[model samples]
Every structure is written in structure tokens, then in C-alpha cells.
Target: MTPCGDTEGDENCIAAIEALFKAYGSLRYGEEVTQLEHALQCGFLAQESGAAPALILAAVLHDIGHMLHPDAAAAVAADQNDAHERLGAQALSKWFGRSVSEPVRLHVQAKRWLCLRHQDYWEQLSPQSKRTLELQGGAMTAPEADEFERLPYSREALQLRRWDDLAKRADHPTPSLSHYLGLARGLLQS
Candidate 1:
């Protein structure tokens, strides 16, 4: 089952985490990275940035939407399908509050912004990054940029971007499935 609340050591949380692990045992992407791995790297980077527990959770779950559905990453661009950020925000909402969701939403925009603004950051991105850049509509006008900047999350957006850059798979260790229980526990209490 999809873990929701802060169940901590609760049976539901355990089951959820276990389910995730069972799902992850030997899963591998065809030629790309796995969602689980990407998320863990993002989480570790968030931790190194000293953001917050919830933000770490946000980064961890940010790409979880891809796990839930196929072609989700592709669906995000050229339409309004922010599958990664949107689904992550909703799933995390059950446990974390806006702390996690807000950042998730902004981070997608942050990636787009970084592509537009931060040249050095863009040049270092992997091939997958280049593809996503095209998919996410690399082209944006000044007015569009202005609206994006108004997204109530300039700081969070930048923070997420910085960590995302830091958390590339080569540099970071693989993600772990151990945090689900603790996160569920927190939600149950709150």
C-alpha cells in the first residue's frame, strides 16, 4: 500500500516501506537511472544542504510519481503534466504538510529556470538532462519567467536546484528505503 501518515513503527508504514522495497529488489531502468536512485540522491543532496527533514522528504519523493505511472516524465512538458512534482506533492501531503509539497512544485520550475539562467549548471547536466530540457520547454519569455519567479518559492526553488545539481548519481550513493516508517510516524502524530 502507498504509505501516507506518520506511522513510524506502525504496521501500515512498515508494509508500505516493505512494499516499496519489494518493488525495488531488482528493478532497473532500461538505459536510464531508476526513480528510486534519483530520489535518494536528491534527498542526500538536500540533507547536505541542511534544508530540513521535510524538504529532504520532498526531494526523496519528488520523482516518486514516475514510479507510480509510466511515461510520466514525458507527460510533464508541452502540456501541464507535472507528474513528478504534482503527484509527489499529493502523496507527501498526507504525511508532510506544505513544507514538502511547495518545494516539489517549485523544483520543476527551478530546473527550467536553471537551464535558462544558470549556464554552467546546464552544461554539466547529463544527456537525460538535455532531453528533459527540451521536454520542459526550454524556451520561456520574459513575462513567463516573471510569472515563474512569482511562484511563492524563489528560495525553495533555488535550494532544490542547488541540491539537484549536487545529487547526480555518480557522486551520491544509492537511495535507501528506510525513511518511510519514520516519516509515517511523524504524520500519524501530527
Candidate 2:
């Protein structure tokens, strides 16, 4: 659980991920579920959906940007756009390829994409999600949506987004972070 910087091929990546959750897991993610709970649920949903290991790993680590930032919950609460998606992607990219990092990078946009594609999607979001949606550039326009859909890994991103939406059950049980770390380690380039 020691703090580890993002270094290429370092053995610390999985440990860092685990440590992050242990440290900040209890913080509410603008929802009833804590950050760690949300992540575990998202990864679990992906696994249940028969998603690839890389995709499941992406789901588990998508919000890593928030963890990388200092007082991320406070920043979100203050309405500051910390660009957690970009930050998280940058961090994950050091260990994984597009199959993993790409989806994490695009997961936020995928949320915006969903809001545009389905009218009910926006209304279904938690209050915190709705607030963050505004900061995430609101719904995508037709041209924007078209561009997003055209991007490589966009489909995966969209699927990840769906799992992200469904991952907020406070009472849901999921495998431990270590279980996922083992799965993700097999997928890591290092």
C-alpha cells in the first residue's frame, strides 16, 4: 500500500491501485455507494456481461483520475472540472494499451454520448452524475456523437459507460480488489 508513482513496467501498478482504493474507498462518489464500491460493481458488471479482461479492467480503473488527484471529491464538490478521465487515462496508459486505456479515456464521453442518444438516460443518472455531466460538456451534438461513435474503441467505451451507469448499487457485493488486480495483471503489458 505504499505510494507509487506511475513508472513503466513497475511491479507497483497493481499495488498502487489496491492502495488507492483502501485509502479513498470510503469517500462517497456523489452517490450512495463509495468510490471503491462503485469501481468493484462496475468491474463486476463487466465480468457478468462476458466482457473481455481488458474491458473489465478498464471499468475497474476508469475513475482512477479522481484517485490520482488530491481531494478529488472536494474538487468535484466545488464544481471544478479536474478532467479525471484524462488524468486517469494518462496514468493507466503507462501500463496498458488502448484496449484498456482507450476505454477509460472515453468513458466520460460515453456518458455524454448516452445522454444524447437516449432521452431517459439523463434523467436516470444520480444527482451527482447529472452535475458532472454538465461539466463533461453536456450531451453530445449530432456531429459530435457521430465523431465519437466513429472513434476506435468507441463501442467498448459505450459498453463501459453502460456498466458504469449500472454500478452504483450501494448494497451490491463484488469480488475483492485483489481478485480484479490478478485479472488485470495478466492483461497488463508489463
Give the top-scoring candidate (lDDT). Answer: 2
Which sections of candidate 1 miss by over 4 Å? 1-14, 24-33, 70-82, 180-184, 187-190
Give me the displacement of residue 170 in model 1, in angstroms: 3.9
- The CA lDDT of each predicted structure is 0.61, 0.85
Question: How do all models score by TM-score?
Answer: 0.74, 0.91
Q: Candidate 2: minimum summed lDDT over ten consecutive residues — where?
A: 1-10
Count of backbone collisions within predicted model 1 = 8
**Candidate 1 lDDT tens digits, 1-190:** 3454343434564465456536652343223445465667777777777877777777666655554445544443323344566765665565457877778767767777766766676788666666666766774566766788887766686787676655555434654667634653554324
Number of the top candidate by TM-score? Answer: 2
Q: Summing lDDT over every window of 10 consecutive residues in candidate 1, give the lowest-scoring window.
A: 24-33
Q: Following a full C-alpha superposition, what root-mean-square deviation does model 1 have from the true structure?
A: 4.3
Any idea what lDDT model 1 has?
Answer: 0.61
| Candidate 2 local lDDT, 87-106, one digit each (tens) | 98888888787899999999
Distance from true location, Cα of 190 in model 1, Å: 4.7
How far off is residue 60 in model 2, in Å? 0.5
